[model samples]
Target chain A: MTDIAGSATRVADIQAAYLAQARSKRVMNLILIVIFAALLIAGFRTADRRNAGGFWDGLPNILDFPADVIGEAIERAHLLPGYLIKYLPSLIETINIAGASTLLGAMAGLVMSLLVTRGLGPVPWLVGPLRRVLDILRAVPEIVIALVLIFMLGGGPVPAMIAIALHTTGALGKLFSEVNENASLRPVEGLASVGATWTQRMLLGVVPQVAPNYLSYALLRFEINIRASAILGFVGAGGIGYDLRNTMSWGAGKFDEAAAIFLLLFLSIVAVDQMSSILRHRLTHGAKPGEIHR
Target chain B: MSAQALHQQTRRNFNRKRLMSFALPGLVLGYFAYIFMAFDMAGLGVRVNLENARTLVSDAYSYKTHVTQDNRTGAVEIAIEGERKGAYAPGTAPGWVRLGETSEIDLGGGHVVTFGGRVTYDVPGYGLVMAEPGAGGVNASLPDGALPDFISLSKNRLMVKTDAGRLTVTRNRAEVFKYSLGWELFFFTLDSPYHGMSPGALFKAAVNGEAGAIWQGFVGNKMWRHGDVGWALLETVLMAFLGTCGAAIIALPLGFLAARNFTPLGGLRFAARRMFDFLRGVDGLIWTIVLSRAFGPGPLTGSLAILLTDTGSFGKMFSEALENVDARQVEGITATGARPLQRYRFGVIVQITPVLLSQVLYYLESNTRSATIIGAITGGGIGLLLTQAINTQKDWEEVSYYIVLIILMVMLMDSVSGWLRRKLIKGNGGGH
Candidate 1:
């Protein structure tokens, strides 16, 4: 009977401890939620105040610009094809900028990745400095370089291409190095034992293993670069975006052209996005067992 | 399969791989050749401005002080960057300049310029070049021999360019530019009381209870605008914070509706998925343009643009996460007779919070960069200041300052978000 009573007291003590712990956890969660909510509200208020137009006042008019563009396109439906054809060259230029930059950046990134990866690199001391170089390249927004280059090189596709390519180099270098870290070192070691140079080893051994992943990442970067190229164009780097800005600046009467350009841009972006996604999916997952490989 | 057939297949694969290895690079090369022509590479040499490049690079690290003598008034004044705000008092000048009726500027390295009755530039290798400005236009005299390439002489104006300094004399004004190696008025403007105070002196002053006054001057500096820069940085971070958290909050429920496992209604799921695609397809640039129309340019527009674009991304990722969640937990909760809401809260949200939090945090870091770019377009944040400074085309030092701050800001955010992700993910793992 005494042993049963002692066991009962122990059970009671365990329940009290659990309940107290749960209550404190609940209080802590509540405090965090309250603080988060307060921050959100305060941030919104500050943003609204700083904005040129208040949020509530501007909220209702959000659809006005889109509506105007759509309405103008509908009215000038016949001229839409002409506008599209007229701007196709610029669109192609934008796409070309993206493609060229992606290609160049990926090649540079591949080499840099090999140089920065531990055990795979020829010179071990280069890793830290190269990593910091990549960091700086990634940190600088394309606009900064593009604008500066535009001042020197004048408004054109080259400045935008170089700027975007430099950024892509940094971004892809870091990502590729991370992929390299997970890659098998056996192939590199085997090639090294055979007196193969760093370049030969990396190209012959490592590249084959990581090519699919690199291609997938490069494809994703291409999609991003297309958008970046368009933006750079808006800032006077020569492309469809420059035309868009011109049409938009003309306002009211020329919105039809703007709408057509918008349609072209939107459609092309979606097309590339879809294509890249499918390709990336295939690259990452591979084909079915019975299917022939690319 | 026979050994002969298998061997043939292997041989064919090798041949195809070898063909691909050559053809792929060839294709890329062909494309680049085309781009070279399309982007006008051949003509780029003629279009390129080496002078502008030199100015941009040089001005980025150095500043020039101007010693001017107004031809009309015959009054001399010294100023940094020739800005009225950076001008010294009538009786005051930098240590390198001796103030008098005839001010003498030591440009260093045996190069000197005297702004007095007649502007005289003393070059080390070249002889003294003198120019007097009056109503009849610049009356100039150079060395007896042929004029050097550095000097550009015209009827109304005379200009001399040297490594250490440059001199320009016109009918209206005569000015000498003395290049220096550091940014001027960076810490404190000419108007500030502590304009040239050393750190030790500043510390001593602070101890003497003048700290607040000194800080006020530094923060309120018209040239550097330290206070404004601090606020701009905060705004940029706020944009990333508001956008990421707001998207996460808005995407959670939409994610549930879109998830195959959570929602039985096929039509609702399809609609939600399509919405996500449409939002993501629109692109942040277009969204920035559209939002800026209604909201005008500011942090609000930038944040909203980020929010709208990220909402689709987060929704799609979240739904994918939700679909992959284990059903066993939900079944266990249902066994306890839990309501649908309670089942989701205890079962689904708990499991996916780590994934969702990590994705959101990662985006928070990237969005800081996006915010900066958007801010440039929308006319807000440090990006706006940078663009404005660049447009002016003379304030390269200011541009460099903003660039450094932007880089530091991005790196800081990157590290902070990374740390938070590691902490939260590990915390969740341990709790389970």
Candidate 2:
């Protein structure tokens, strides 16, 4: 009986220690939560203080601009189709910028990925420097290049295209290199044994293996590039964004035009989003459900 | 299934592949041709300003010192980059310039310029180019030889450009610009007592109790505004952090509403999902424009715009994650007599916390880049400063500086976010 009692007390002591640890852990988590909350609050307050308008004051007027634009758009509903037709060319230009940049960037990225991949690379010493170059290219926002180019090249779509392409090269190069690392080197070795050039080896041995994944990533980059190109247009690079800026700056009178541009942009983005997602899904999954293979 | 039939099929496949190979390149070339025309590539050559390119390239790495003399008063002034902020004090000038009745500027390479009642540029290869500026306009004379292409003389203006320097004479003033390497007044302006100190001397000064003063000089540099730039960089980073974290926080519960397994109500899920779609589809540019209209402009507007758009993105992603959560964990929690909320806390939240945190951290780094672009649109943070510097067109050095800082800022954020993701989501086994 004394032995049983001693065992029970020992078990109780262990339970007490576990509970204490649990309690301390909870307390530490609570403190961390408190600190995080404090940081959020402080950061918001600082941002508000630095802002041109206060949050509360702006909250009520948040919907006012949208409402006004929508109201005018509805009031001038008949002109909507005409405005859409008018801006169609600009929209096409924007899409072209995105598409061209994606194509050029993807090509550049393919070269860069092949150059940087450990197994495929010709010059091992260049890999680190090339990676750093990509990082720098990625780090620079498109607007910086676009704005600088605007200074030298003047306001046009070319600046935005170059800017977006440079960024896409960096982004897609990184992704492509990651894809490249997983590729089998047996084909490359076979090609080398057959006396193929470096270019021929990469094109034949690796390109076929990673083409699907590369296409999927490039499609995603194209989607992003569309948005980037539009944003660049807002800052004096030519396109629909330029038109939007002009209409917006025109204030109340041109709200209808602004609305029209907004609808067009929204519809295009959604369509692209849907189409690309479906394509990506198909690429990854090989085919749709119950599709005939013939 | 005969050998002949199989051979025919193989031939067809090979032919189709060959056709595709040729057709793809042809199509790509065709598209490029179309784009070249559409984008007016032919006109771009004419549109490109080589002079502006030269200025931008040179100004990014080099600065010019200006020596100017008033024709009426003969008051001479020496300034870096010809900015009023970089003016030399009275009775003081660069070593190459000798301040006297006639300010004599040694342009190096045996080229010299003197500015007073008369402006004289003594070119080493050529003879003296003299110009007298008065109310009657600049009367100029060049050496009695074949005039070099670098010298241009007219009734009102006389200009001489050489490898050493450039001299321009007009009725109102005579100015000589001497080109030099490196950014001048980068750390301390002319007013700072430690302006001309070498790095070794600066260290010695700091050791001798002048560290604070030296720091103040650097921070308060009239030419650079390092302190303000630093604050702007911080604001940009803060915008990204606050926006990303706020979006994640706001989206977590909404995600529960949108997820099929969590919400149970089809109507509520549809509504929530549609709201997410709408927010995301509107895009950040539109949000920024709309928000800036209300909030005027600042880092707050930028952050809010980021928050609003990212909330949509996070909502969709989080809901998807929630829908994929393992039900076994919830069952295990429930077997312990845990309440519904307790089950969710232990099973659902715990399961998705790593995913949510990693996604949020990833967005934080990307949003830093986005914040910069948004900051430009909304007139806040370093983007504002960068845009302003670029807009001026004359401040290429400042533009380059801001570009370097932005690159560093983004790389720093990239590494930091990557580090945090690794530290926080270890052993979670979720796709980043």
Candidate 3:
């Protein structure tokens, strides 16, 4: 009977200890949440203070611009089709810039990935330096390159293409190298045994293993590049964004044209986003039973 | 499962693989061919400005100091990059420039230019070129024989260009440009007392308790604007932090409302999801343009633009995570007599917090870059400074400086976000 009493006390002691730990954990969480909330409020306040217009003052006027644009667009609904057709060439130019850059970037990224991946690369010493090159490339904003190139290349699609391509190479290189790390080396070794060159081995042995993943990533990058190309165009690299900027500068009356460009841009972005998602889904998760060899 | 059928299948697979191997590259090549014409690659050569390229490349690594003599007053002035802020004091000049009535500028490598009543450039391998700026325009004399391509002469102006330096004389002034390596006036402007001090001397002066003055000079540097740059960098990071964290906050509840399992009302879920889609589809560029109109171009505008676009993304992603959550945990919490809110706090929130945190942190790093781009559009942060510097076209060194800072900032953010992700999401799962 005395042993049973001791056991009951031990159970009570364990329960108390657990409860104390639980109480401290709750307090810590509460403190964290409070701090987070405080930070958010402070950040918003600081931003509002620094802003040209106060947040509260601007809040009511937020919908005014959108409403005006929409109203004008409805009034000029008949001209909308003409404006879209007129800007079709520019839109196509923007899409082509993205496509060409994605292709070029993917190609360069492929080579860089093969050269930088640890087990797959021919030169072991080059890995660190090449990785840094990719890092710097990835770190640079596309607009920086595009602006400089626009100054030198005279503001066209080419500068945007080159800028986007360079950034893509850097971003895709890093991603591709990661994919390369996961690739099996058995096929590479088999190719090497037959005295295949490094390029050949990488192309035949490694690429086939990682092709689907690479394509998926490249497709995603293409969607991003489309946005980047449009932004670059706004800075005078020549695309639908250039037209948008021109119309925007004209203000009041030309807002309908701006609205049309906005509509086209939105629809295209949504279409690309949807299409790429479907393609990426196929590339990643839709491998049929007989497609394992790929 | 006959041998004949298996052999036929293998042959067919090989044929398809071989066809694909050739067809893929062919398709790509055809696309590139079309792109070549579409982008007007053939016409690009004529439009390319090699001179601007040369200037950009040379200006990036080197700076020019201007030594000018006004014809009207016969007074010589030496300034770095011809900027009034970088002008040497009335009686002071660099060692390469000898300040006197007849100031001699050693452009290095036997290229010496004398500026006095008339400007004379002594070319080592060639002969001396002299020009006098007077009422009758720059009467210039060059070495005998065929005129070299380096020298261009007109009735009013004469310019002698060499690898070492360049000399130009017109009716108004005679000027010499001496190019040197590295950014000039980077640490302290000529107005600063510590302008020309060596690094060792600076250190010694700091040890002598002049550290504050030295730092003041460096930070308040009019030319480089180090203090402004520091603030810009901070503002950029703040934009990213506020935008990303704010998006996560706004999206968490919206994500739950959009999630199929969490919100029983189909219409509410559909509305929430569509709201996300519309927000994302409009794109950050449009958001930036629209918000800048209301906010009038500042960090607030940039952060809001990022916040708006990322809310859509985070909402969609978070809802997916909420839907995929295990139901057993919620059931277990409910069985313990927990209320609806308590069940979500203990079961649902705990399960999704790591996923949400990791995604939010990942967006924080990328959003830094986005914030920079938006800043350029909205006229805030380092992006504005970068664009302003680049637009000047003559401040390539500053452009390079901003580029380096941007790269460092992005990389630093990248690593910080990675570290936080690892710490917060330990053993739970991985992030994109």
Candidate 4:
């Protein structure tokens, strides 16, 4: 009976200690939360001070521009379809830029992935340098290259295409190489034993294994490239974004045109977003029984 | 199934595969062909400006010093890149330039230019080209031979280009541009006493208590504006940090609202989901444009733009993560007699915090790059500086400098975020 009583006392002491630790942990977390909140408040204030207009003052006016555009667009709704039709070619140009760049970039990225992947690389020493190359390519904002190219190429879709492609290559190369790492090397070794060249082994053995994932990643990149291409056009690379900028700069009288362009961009982005997601879903999880082998 | 039937099926599948392989390549080829015409690749060759390319490439590595003489005032000025900020003070010139009544510029390969009443260029191979700027025109004479293509002569302007330098004499002024390697006035402007100090000497001076002075000179350098660039970089990082963190903070609760398991009311869930979709569909470029309209082109607008766009993305991702959370943990918390908020705090939040934090951190690094691009459009951060430098056309050295800094900044952020991710999510399934 004395032993049981002693053990019960020890158990109560241990529970008290655990409660103390938990309470202290809660206090520490609360302190952290307070500090984080303080930082957020301070950051917002600093940003407000640095901004040209105050946030509170600007908040009310946030919807003003959109409303004006919508109101003007509604009044001139008759010209909306005509404007959309007129700008259809520009929209197509933008989509074409994205598609072409994605294609070119994916091809470059595929080769790079093959060259850089651990088990599949032709030269081990080249991997580090090639990875750094991709990192630099990815690091550079497309505007930097696009603007520079615009200076040299005299303003066209080509500069935007090249800039976006370079970036996409870097992005997709990293993703593709990651996918390549998970691929089975058995087929590659078998092909190598049969005296297949490096390129043939990669194309026939590794490519088939990772093609679905690569396609999915490339499709996602294409979606991103579409937005990038549009933004590039805003900086004078030529497309719907250029038209939007033109209409925007014209300001008051051209709100309807701006609205039309905005609608087109919105619809296209949403459409592409939906289509790519669906396609990626299918590629990843909906592979047919026979498709897996290929 | 018989072996003959299986063989027939295999043959049919191989034929289909063969047909698909050919068709895929053909389709891709056709698309490329269409793009070629659509993007006008044929006209691209004609559209390219080789001269601009040469200038951009050469100017990125070299700077030209301008020696100009005003015909109206009889005053001579020497400036780097012909910028007023880079102009040399009176009675001061580079060692290569001898300042006197007639300034003699040594263009190094035995090529010398003397600027006086008449500008004389002594070319090593082509002899002398002399030009006199007058009220009527630039009376000019070149070496007596077939006039070389390098020399462009006219009634009003006489331009003599050589391997070492270029001299142009006009009706109002005579200017000589001598090219040199490296970015001049990068560390110190002409006004700084430490302008031409060697590294060894500068270090010695710094050791001898002139460190603050030297640092001030460099930071306040008018040509490079290191102080301004540093601030711009900080502002960019700040935008990213505030945007990403702010978005995560705002989206966390909204994610709960959108999650089907958490929010029982389907109407609220639908509203939250559609709100996220609307925010995302508008895109960052549009948000930047719209926000900049209100905030008037600054870092705040940039941050807000990023915040809004990322909120949508984070909302969707966070909701998905919340939905996938193990329900047993929440049930156990409830069994402990915890309140609803406390249960969620220990259950769902604890479970998804790693995923949420990792995603937020990943976006932080990417948002740094996005902030740069947005900053360009909104006229904030390093992007603004980069765009402004590039727009100046002759500041390719500065452009290169900004580009290098931007790449370094991004790489630094990438490594930092990657390190944090490893440290924070090491044993968690969230590890990349």
What are the DockQ scores of the candidates, in order?
0.49, 0.50, 0.49, 0.47
Error of 1 at A26 (Å): 2.5
Determine which window of 10 residues in candidate 1 chain B has minimal summed lDDT: B423-432
Give each model's whole-structure lDDT: 0.89, 0.90, 0.90, 0.89
Question: How far is A216's C-alpha from truth in model 1 (Å)?
Answer: 1.1
lDDT of 4 by residue, A29-121 (tens): 689789879988887887788889999999999999999899999999999999999999999999999999999999999999899898799
lDDT minimum window of 10 residues, candidate 2 chain B = B423-432
The DockQ-derived docking category for candidate 1 is: medium
- Give the runs in model 4 whose Cα sits over 4 Å from its true position: A1-35, A286-294, B71-74, B132-139, B207-209, B427-432
Position B202, candidate 4: lDDT = 100
Which tens-of-lDDT digit does each residue in B312-424 have in candidate 1?
88998899888978899999999999999999889888898887887898888888888888888887887788889899999999888999999999999989999988887
Give the poorly placed runs of model 2, Cα more than 4 Å off: A1-25, A286-294, B207-209, B427-432
After superposition, the stretches of candidate 3 with alpha carbons farther than 4 Å from their true spots are A1-17, A286-294, B1-9, B207-209, B427-432
What fraction of the reference interface contacts is present in each model, in order?
Answer: 0.63, 0.72, 0.63, 0.63
Where in model 1 is the C-alpha error above 4 Å? Answer: A1-8, A286-294, B1-8, B430-432
Q: Give the top-scoring candidate (DockQ).
A: 2
Instruction: Give the Cα error of residue A231 in candidate 3, in Å.
Output: 1.0
TM-score of chain A of 4: 0.92
Scored against the native two-chain complex, candidate 2 gets a DockQ of 0.50
Tens-digit lDDT track of model 1 for A1-294: 999999999999999999998899789879989999999999999988888988999999999999999999999999999999999999999999999999999999999998999888789999999999988888888898998999999999999999999999999998899889889989988998999987899999899999898998899899889989998899899999889889988989899999988888889999998898889888989522111100
lDDT of each residue in A1-294, candidate 3, tens digit only: 999999999999999999998899779878978998998888888778877888888888898889889999999999999999999899999999999999999999999999999998899999999999998898888988998899898989999999999999999999999899999999999999999999899988999899999998898899889999999889899998899899999989999999999999999999998998888888889542111100
